[model samples]
Target: MLKKYKDDQEFYSLVGIKPQTFYKMLEILKIAESKQKYYGGRKNKIVIEGRLLMTL
Candidate 1:
């Protein structure tokens, strides 16, 4: 089964990650976006839509 998350809170609930860690991961993904100039890989990408995070 797969689910799409609408916020950090929803993602946390679905993945069972702690609030602190969830926010940290979101922060890291945001930072990595700026550093991804030549990098291209499906696994390394962060998929956030509006407040939604897509996962499979």
Candidate 2:
């Protein structure tokens, strides 16, 4: 299930979730361990990256 892209915004757009909710879901998935670098930005992009990783 490896994603074909590197942008998280694309992923969230495909999944239809708000950026905040997507971050929460990633936290619940236990994959937000290194989140400091991802704070304060278009989080949809970050979420997409996480989603791609999850798929992998």
Tell me, by TM-score, which candidate is best: 1
Instruction: Tell how far residue 32 is off in model 1, in angstroms.
Output: 0.5
In model 2, pairs of residues that clash are 8-48, 8-49
Q: What is the lDDT of residue 18 in candidate 2?
A: 52
Score every model by TM-score. 0.42, 0.32
Model 1's lDDT to the true fold? 0.56
Look at candidate 2 and tell me the lDDT of residue 37.
42
The whole-model lDDT of each prediction reads: 0.56, 0.56
lDDT of 1 by residue, 1-56 (tens): 22445776876676677556756667876676657734764543434422324431
Q: Residue 25's C-alpha lDDT in candidate 1? A: 68
Question: lDDT tens string, model 2, 9-49?
Answer: 87667767655675566666654534644565443545545
